[model samples]
Target: MPSQATTAPRVALVTGTSSGIGAAVVEHFCKLGHQVLAVDFNPAGKAVAGKAGAVFYEADLSDPDACRGAVTEAVKRFGSVDILVNNAGIQHVASIETFPEEKWHQIIDLMLTAPFLLTQAAWPHMRKKGWGRIVNVASIHAQVASPGKAAYTSAKHGMIGLTKTAALEGGEQGITANAVCPAYVKTPLVDNQIADQAKLNNMDEQDVVEKIMLKQAAIKRLIEPEEVAQLIAYLASDAAGAVTGSSFNIDLGWTAH
Candidate 1:
């Protein structure tokens, strides 16, 4: 009844679009004839969105007001945020006792609280339209944990909880919420982690990824950003209408063990 997913153009608000999976999502959605509002804290995101033919909004989502403002900007520019992708995040590696209090709070605020605020801000718009899709980009750590990643793991785990809650609340209103938990992806974010991982493991940077990051992965390789983007697109499409309250793992069999 709703027609195929690509028949109509939906407005999408995607965060962390300066590079990596965020940029890939922007490009993919735009190619599907959707209007996209690309939000990122990095000023360079303006250029990335321009290249992708998406409107760009720069905001530090850790700020509660900024999180709400991002959704407001999307509605202001594209009429409504028909699709919301909570994909902006960062990683900090340290033992629980050694992790800085400020960093932990920042990570939780940005990765966990921001998504909640954004969802709250977008809920009314979606309810009014009787249709919406929410995709949270969680990680393999959401379901499992590793040492020296206290804040990152905690926030990702929280994200899956938020996704489930949103799915439950949105079900009767024609909105669906889901999370994609991917293993290490070939993105700048993961690349940035290599140094910290190497330092934490006392290993060479190259060996850190091969011997550590992908060691448990049956595929023995990092996922590409575009690959994760494809899964997010599918979850956001009308074809996935029945798929809600689910956490799909793109972990290359790492979780299969």
Candidate 2:
């Protein structure tokens, strides 16, 4: 549990809150007494949000208008958004030579473009309040890459770039922006990827897990969603105001090499 002062009640808007890291983040914030706005296309998001005492909004983040609308609704319901977590993303694996053009566009739009628009929409509100926290959930792939993940890797890299630039711009206003880069997390996303990789490479799911996913981690273990959520909760708090324009890694030493 986070300290009460560190989790002081604030209005937080977290995208991709339906499950995994995003859902954990929402729950953490609510436990810290923050008013949360949970956004996701998943129908179950509303129930999850309700349980966390957060207001829920269902929308496809790939749509720029929907991203903007979510921000608008948050402002209307909460008066202001003190924190924003850009966590919605998707993965499509294929070699560069054979990657589908449509998949490339969709991945980039959802992971990179949506964050840009949401940040743009929320900027003025944060500026008015003179305090804000924006944490982008990037991946270790933001700095390192593996085969068959060009679209996912590129979008993660772009997210880091966006985080840095936004941090620089928001610093003068007491608003902070940062990115958290983590390795394979034990989430539905990774579970789905394991199955997808098994089918794609004609290997057993266990082989995919051992031979591919954990091959590079020093710990050789998947990270828990709550672990990443704890870091996010810290960054979203008033205590992290000084920690901006940076990429913090929770990759179990994957990038140390």
C-alpha lDDT score of every prediction, in listed order: 0.91, 0.90
RMSD of 2: 1.4
> For residue 5, what is the lDDT in candidate 2?
34
- For all candidates, what are the clash counts? 0, 0
The TM-score values for the models, in the order shown, are: 0.97, 0.96
Tens-digit per-residue lDDT, 132-186, candidate 2: 9999999999989988899999999999999999999999998999999999998
What C-alpha lDDT, on a 0 to 100 scale, does residue 35 get in candidate 2? 84
Tell me the tens digit of each residue's lDDT in model 1 across 80-191: 9899999999988888878999999999999999999999999999999999999999999999999899999999999999999999999999999999999999998888
Please tell me which predicted candidate would have the highest lDDT against the true structure: 1
- Show the lowest summed lDDT stretch of 10 residues, model 1: 1-10
lDDT computed for candidate 2: 0.90
